[model samples]
Target: MVRCSHVHLYKNGKCNSWQIGKEDKKRMASNQGSSHLNGHSDIFLATSRDDQILFNGILFYLGQKYIEGAQHLPWWRTDGVILTVLLHAGPVEFLYYWLHRALHHHFLYTRYHSHHHSSIVTEPITSVIHPFGEHIAYFTLFAIPLLSTVLTRTASIVSFAGYITYIDFMNNMGHCNFEHIPKWIFSAFPPLKYIIYTPSYHSLHHTQFRTNYSLFMPFYDYVYGTMDKSSDSLYESSLVRKEESPDVVHLTHLTTPESIYHLRLGFAYLASEPHKSKWYLWLMWPVTLWSTMVTRIYGRTFTIERNIFKNLKLQTWAIPKYSIQYYMQWQRESINSVIEDAILDAEEKGVKEEGLNRNGEFFVRKHPQLKVKLVDGSSLAVAVVLNSIPKGTTQVVLRGNLSKVAYSLALALCKGGIQVFTMREDEYKKLKEKLSDEAGNNLILSKHNVPKTWLVGDGLSEDDQQKASKGTIFVPFSQFPPKKTRKDCLYNNTPAMLAPKHLENVDSCENWLPRRVMSAWRIAGVLHAMEGWNVHEVGNMMFDIEKIWKASLDHGFRPVTSFAESKAN
Candidate 1:
């Protein structure tokens, strides 16, 4: 009688037979006993169930899509395999390469691809445990080859189903915590050996993503020069030292503030602090205000032009000379073209400027509306808002000069019924005083008490400061007195008091805030600003008013207006 480790009794009072080798049976009994002893059977079952559910869901969705596509191409067509391979292979290879590169792109890698890399030491389950977007992207990309094929409908469907099953098994086995499958099995069918991917092969692929991209066959990877043989050597070497402990790998250190900012931004959407009561919703108002102030103060100064050439050079790790020359040439052409157009417009408008300098710097000596114009005729706008001027307290200083062009913009936002908050009584008084004169008595100023927290301004009792610092935005302004100069505000005493080390390297005011903060700020601010205004009017007004403008030629539109003088009668 053949004994099986797993036994099931039939309703007919008979037992189904399965082969259980003597050694295998003993090992199985030992593992079961150990699991029972440690009370780990439930944990194992739960893990297994989770894995099964996830795998089944992914597989079912992918399979359904494949089947739908396959229905159009039946299996009766002769030479279908040849046609399918020919048509599908090239496009699949291209898309695979493109997506593979895109996965490594700075933004995508940080958010989506990084999740996959979390499992430094991968198992088959790890392959499927990725961001849903990434998983979908990979699945879709893989299916493209089948979709592009000219195989008969039935053949295509059958082949795709078989392929998925094969892939699933291979992926699982690759991460299988076992070694040494029968070598004779692979040797029996030499071609099928390459056709069917193995755990060993797929394991190497995960270990080093640059190679082993081929799902079933190595032919495409070889042709594309992406098939790395070095991973094979690494795998073989690992196997040779089977007795050695599994090598531990740690995640790469996120050493910069920018990295941390990105991480926080990605997580912020999903994270929520527990709250109760309608009034707690108002707490988010202050958070929104703080986010807006920090984002605006930081995002502008750090705007770098997106140069494809520079990016390519960085990717290749090229020398500075070539990169700089490439950048300069591109910059020169771009500037010159803008200047030519600007010069023509100025000449037509009867405006004069100083002769273009060697560096093409031009200056207008006098212009009523134009504060300062570049040789390229670009203008600068500055806004200065000084608030909270009181004795013994640091002045709430906002110093940036707004150009005549931006006056209308500022007015529109203020006029759109935004409740501007000021800490200083005098500052609020000044604004209120001007409102009737400038805004036709539409703007009203009420004495709403400013948050005491805002007045604290880096000055509070140690415990209070610590509490304020816990979740508050810390903007390190050069103009603000340093820790040594500030008598009241504690600084550099502990990690909480000090500016994050990453912020030290970030010199530009514009680049200080992360992108997500900027996005949230704009969204929150616009909503708040449009509170009393007609939604339609506010929406129309906001049509072209960009909240965040990158430093580029296209930064803000030049509004055209026709100025006419009344005829002398």
Candidate 2:
């Protein structure tokens, strides 16, 4: 039979492959061309793996019985044994090359070899795994070596057993995924390097799939011109790696900001509602959260004044008559369109991009270099994240005519002693009309047109210097910085566009801040979720206001409403 060693064939219950849960296994299979098929479905009708293995085993035993009873030859006559052994190797290798190549034919690849390629890394026991039809083809081809000796009546069972054992030994070694050939051996006999294959040599075939298709030796690959360019270098590297621990990556859903928040909420809800009291019934808060998330389909729409309803038009007065879900969906679509337009506009204006993919799409490599934890979180989630910045950070910078919601957010940062830097006096005055009198005065805006001085500290390194960096926080509604400028002393929360991707979960509770100051809290939550800070730190800011600001950005969680006897600490 053709010696196929690179990829493993099957993995069911004790599978070390990526699949863990039943649902996930089925989902994984969906990507591999069988989206509609069930995970455990047999390859063909009446072709269960158990039945195939049993049938193949019966054939092997019968072959052995026939050889013993019918060969009628000495177990080991030196001349006959030698002749049969020499006769077996030549034709077996020749036929195997063609048969193996045929297996890669489009129809055969999908039906037969695709099952083998499922495992990118092979284990030794995975050697015999194959489709029943594939095994049948193998059995027919493997009989050539035995049939040649028998037809000439030159067969000795002893010689046949020795040849078969050699093939199995070499095949298992190829699949072991460990380099057993020492580097000194290759250096000692350079000619033997042409004949022997390493685990790394076969592994390239599994991962890259275009070259290195040989069973016993790479001689055919050399003659047919199918060798991979990196095979020899890879083989050398695998030998060096033999003494080191192998790298392994486990496949599973990683923790996210959403899952973290959900777990925390669920944990506290259960603690407060321990089984001793009715509060214990609040253990269902996660289910409630999930349900609200499932049902939350809403958005905040802007108007000439203020509109609480889900308004479609930008400047129209809106009444509280539409579903929140409809509003949120509208905002999602509007955001995507605006972002697309902005990107195109930037490109037209000759704005340079940092990173480009194969498809020629430009990526913002330096948009923000957040801590790894906030890599995939929403921009808005940062509004609620907290840092250890002193409660005395009181500077403001306004860049342009920003939304009223944004001004209110700047006001909150000012309350926490933050310094914000923004636009010139004319721009600040225009923005002042959008905010209420109390918020407008508290903004603490800084005029950026005037130049400021700073110590150079040119001779001193960062550690040697006595001073540290500080400046205004930037959370503009929209911004486009000049080419190649790295704005470090700012937290530019202005999104590229208001796309669905820009939002957190597309649910109602996603932005369920109280109606009176919804914009401020939402912006705060987004700010809070970024940097190395998170929602828990934001919670610390409201330790005294137990009833109002207990949980997360929305402050949605509360103890039993009637449990007024004692407030939770």
Candidate 3:
């Protein structure tokens, strides 16, 4: 193994770390995009045949100039090589600015430039991962600095070598996932940073796009008024642990067996002091083990953007790009059957024409004062409807945490229209608080109470009349609550339609342990069916599971299904 030097630079920040050295041969052969979990790629940093060809050509061209008495190359002349690099950047930057901008045009981005943007989280190698045409153009523009030195007869091999070295170094630094530069780097020099762009500044271009578009300097972006405002703070927090959203799939991720080996390191955290229950870790340990075993025995399902698969030319077990038809028949009438049965149940409760769904406007008879916009349907005439009331409607009826029902609600909130979410006084009050905190500033979540005819406004600051035509919401049940009168929160003479205490916790158990366990099994079901994991991915997962299994065995845990465990309980 080679020594891992250069750790000091990005040690604190979260960026793709790179070092100038020989790389592993095995990694290059696999040709995978990045470490699926850790998100890394070192192949781009390794010297390839293409680099040999380009550098050979450059050396040959420089060799001819060396014979023409260019040996001194301002070495002992009027000034130093740093002056030559700045001079080189001027013309190159001007030429590259327009070329780079042109590459972002729609057709060019799809065909050529978008390849670089394929990796949202970039590494040092990602810096040089441009298409052939783009790379060829880049090499040509970069050589202009050398060509000008030759044409003007102003520099030698040393100056040209140093100048090119500076260019490559800056390019690599821009792509590194870490921002090593301290705040005092600017405060100490002040003027130096105004010209140079930081790694985070360059990262924004990859993640956000349409801003910070200079070759190496920030001067052009400032002059063109295209600089991002949050560049500084974004850089500082780049390495910090991001606050997670409650509805994110990663929340349920099992990092235990993977990190169980690090028990000594995490022992303190597991032995909670306060706030968290002292027995929280011990209590959840068995639950975690059970959930993990269920998931391991089954498998997992995950989705990456289709473009990533296409761009990487990855070998997928399942089709990368999918049409609507691909997902339509997959459920095999199960969902259709459920909807039908639910609809039949609704009719029995005398729920006919309970609400007026005229054109796009809707008015529920139960909440007579409410006016709503009935947005388009989600699945099988199940509409996403939104409306506002006098004091504001809140308190949606769904309870269990992060189920299919909760996922649907999260998706509805993310429709770019939902501004605020309100919860009710229930057993899930703590969950509500956690969800609100994790949601961050993206949404306004509160514990306010409202009737069951829930409303999610369009999030516009304009008056209700002006924004009446645009908003979306969803009711988890097959039909809206059948409230015939203002005081009615349920259907007439039907206790099933009323709030039943027994059914409230049917989807879950104490502290939602059963829900979490079931969700793990559900994930396995998806993974077993999902066609994406390649042979290599499958091998890695199987290996991890073996280790987890051995670890569980040592702890007296015998993996068993809930059906078997429930009877014992």
Can you give the TM-score per candidate against the true fold? 0.28, 0.35, 0.35
Report lDDT per candidate.
Answer: 0.34, 0.39, 0.39
Runs in model 2 deviating more than 4 A are 1-38, 41-53, 64-73, 79-88, 242-569
Query: What tens-digit string does per-residue lDDT give for candidate 2 at 519-548?
Result: 222222222322213222211122122211
Candidate 1, residue 434: Cα displacement in angstroms equals: 99
Candidate 1 achieves a global lDDT of 0.34
Q: Could you tally the backbone clashes for each prediction?
A: 15, 42, 6
> Per-residue lDDT of 1-569 in model 1, one digit per residue for the tens?
00000000001111121223576435433422221223554454355446656855777566556755544545444354555555444565457656765665556766566555444345556656555565556666656545545233434555555455755676567666344555566568766544544556655554454567665556566667777776445434444532211011000112112222222232233112111123333546655455445633431211111111110110000011111222366555543333334333333333221112122222122222431122211111111011111124321221112222223322443464433334345544554554445442433333343222122222323443343322232222111112233344332110001112221222211122222111111121122221211111111122222321212113221111100112222
TM-score of candidate 1 relative to the true fold: 0.28
On a 0 to 1 TM-score scale, where does candidate 3 land against the true structure? 0.35
Model 3 agreement with the true structure over 80-188: per-residue lDDT tens digits: 3555676655878877877877876666776667657665667777777765677678778876756566666766667776776777799889888777777777888
Q: How far off is model 1, as Cα RMSD?
A: 27.4
User: What lDDT does candidate 2 reach at residue 269?
Assistant: 40
- Candidate 3 runs further than 4 Å off: 1-83, 239-569
- Model 1 regions lying over 4 Å from their true place: 1-90, 145-157, 177-198, 201-229, 238-569
Q: Candidate 3 — which pairs collide?
A: 15-177, 15-178, 16-177, 73-156, 300-527, 318-531
